[model samples]
Target chain A: MNKRELAKRVAEKCGQSQVVSTLVINTFISCILESLEAGEKITIQDFGTLSVKQQKKRERFNLATNKVETYLPYDYIKFTASKSVKIKQKEKSVKKE
Target chain B: MNKRELAKRVAEKCGQSQVVSTLVINTFISCILESLEAGEKITIQDFGTLSVKQQKKRERFNLATNKVETYLPYDYIKFTASKSVKIKQKEKSVKKE
Candidate 1:
């Protein structure tokens, strides 16, 4: 599913127009990005937490090139799903199995 | 930050009422949860992808009791940030350094 499909579903469920849903989605994304860029975390109930973790600069060997290179440290996003989500997902998968 | 803070920022930026913004945010989260429950991946542009990964059941030894236990399989959510987000985060960290 992409943004358009998600927006459609949200609009239907929220009884709102797709245009407004799309705008809200955009705003939501923008807010997350801004917060992460500012080194902050966003915690949404029953969803997950979005945060950035800074990795240390390290040397890694390139398998294809057979050379060692120093990679600069960068921040990466980490998301941990809520316990309720985890339980639900596990239940579904177990039923499928 | 929490959901309320996020909704406040989004409402301010989108010039929408807090009630509407909160609704949108809730809908956004619900949409994601529903998609994941249905085993679908959501890809938001310039944000990241949300998907579920199932792990196989395995046996592990308990550290404290030293007893072997079988752990049930579970599904987990994974998120990977966009290249633009990575670059921006790196730049900010470099400036701080």
Candidate 2:
């Protein structure tokens, strides 16, 4: 499911109009990404933690080239799901509420 | 920032009430988790791809125990960030809209 489809489902489940749901969903994404870009560690209840992690530069020797290649340092997003999510994964199916 | 703080920020940015924003945020999380539990891959544009992945079982020698250890397979959530998000990370500051 993409954002559009998820928005529809969210709208129906939350009793909100499609327009409202779509707007809020888009806004939420923008807001979260903005925070993430700012290097904030965001923790969503029952979902996960969103943060940026740095991968240090490393040098590796290539047997074929017989030279060391240095890789640049990098920053990337990391998400660690909440324990509940893991429990749910084990459930194999969502229990309807 | 946790969900409460995130909801407050989202509410301020989206011009929604704190109550409404909180409700919508909670609902959105629940909706996404429900789908994830059902084995659906969720793709949020400009954010990332959310999916479940499995780590297969393997045998490894335990140096301390001096024996072979059998590990069971494990399933976990995986998130891959979009290219735009990486670009945003480089921006260091969000462009005010």
Candidate 3:
């Protein structure tokens, strides 16, 4: 499923037009991106939280040179879904297969 | 930030009412959750994709008994932000401090 498909489903479930749903979806993404870029974490109840975490730099082997190399530290965004969501997914997968 | 803050920002940016924006945001999250629970991956351009990945079961030690124990397999959701989003986040963090 992509954005378009998700938009269609959202529109159907929310009883809204697809165009409006699509715009809302896009705007939601933009909003999330803006918040994350501003160093803010977004949390949704019964879903999960989106936040940026700093990854520590460490020495890694240079495959070509076989020498230790230092890599720059950076941030990574992580999402940990809620337990209820995971259980629902597990049940669905189990039923399908 | 939290959902309310995000909704405010989104409403301001999109020129939409907070109620509508909140509804849209909630719907968007629900749509994504549904897709993931259906074992389908949802991708948003310029943002990221939400997918469930299987985690292999393995044997682990029972702390109290200190004996080998079988662990159940499960699924985990992962979100990898796009390169552009990462760059923007890095810049924003750097400027703030």
Which candidate leads in lDDT? 1
Residues A13-50 of candidate 1: C-alpha lDDT, one tens digit per residue: 99889998899889989888888888788898888898
TM per candidate comes to 0.85, 0.86, 0.83
The prediction achieving the highest DockQ against the true structure is 1
lDDT of 2 by residue, B15-97 (tens): 88888778778888888888877778899998899988777778999999999998876678899998877634655533334
C-alpha RMSD between model 1 and the true structure: 3.1
lDDT of 3 by residue, A30-67 (tens): 87776777777888777889887877667999999999
**Error of model 2, residue A59, in angstroms:** 1.4
Q: Relative to the unseen true structure, what is the C-alpha lDDT of residue B28 in candidate 3, on a scale of 0 to 100?
A: 81
DockQ for all models: 0.62, 0.46, 0.58
Q: B-chain TM-score, every candidate?
A: 0.83, 0.84, 0.81
Residue B76 of model 2 has an lDDT of: 82
Colliding pairs, model 2: none
The TM-score of predicted model 2 comes to 0.86
Best-to-worst ranking by TM-score = 2, 1, 3
The number of clashing residue pairs in model 2 is: 0
